[model samples]
Target: MSSQPSCSQTTPSSATQSIRPVSIKQLQTLGGASGDDDAL
Candidate 1:
């Protein structure tokens, strides 16, 4: 029972770790584009 819960917890964390970087990179790209437009 304890092991099951640990496994479940780890699964979501690993999934999020994979997704979070892609999301951050996309946001950074969009922010940079907007910032450049604002500067001009």
Candidate 2:
């Protein structure tokens, strides 16, 4: 699961650079759907 950290890092950076709204939405959905996984 070493690749998991890389994926987690890349996802937020890419999202921040590309789409703010989508990132916000994804975070919101993740927060609502899963409390623990929201750390991603």
Candidate 1 lDDT tens digits, 1-40? 9999999999999999999999999999999999999999
lDDT of 1 at 12: 100
Q: List the residue pairs that clash in candidate 1.
A: none
Query: Which residue pairs of candidate 2 clash?
Result: none
In model 1, the runs with Cα more than 4 Å from the true position are: 27-40
Instruction: Give the top-scoring candidate (lDDT).
Output: 1
For model 2, the local distance difference test gives 0.86
Tens-digit lDDT string for candidate 2 (1-40): 9899999999999878789878889989887879765655
Give the distance in Å from residue 13's predicted Cα in candidate 1 to where it truly belongs. 0.7
- Alpha carbon lDDT of residue 13, candidate 1? 99
lDDT of each: 0.98, 0.86
> lDDT score of model 1?
0.98
As a whole number from 0 to 100, the lDDT of residue 21 in candidate 2 is: 78
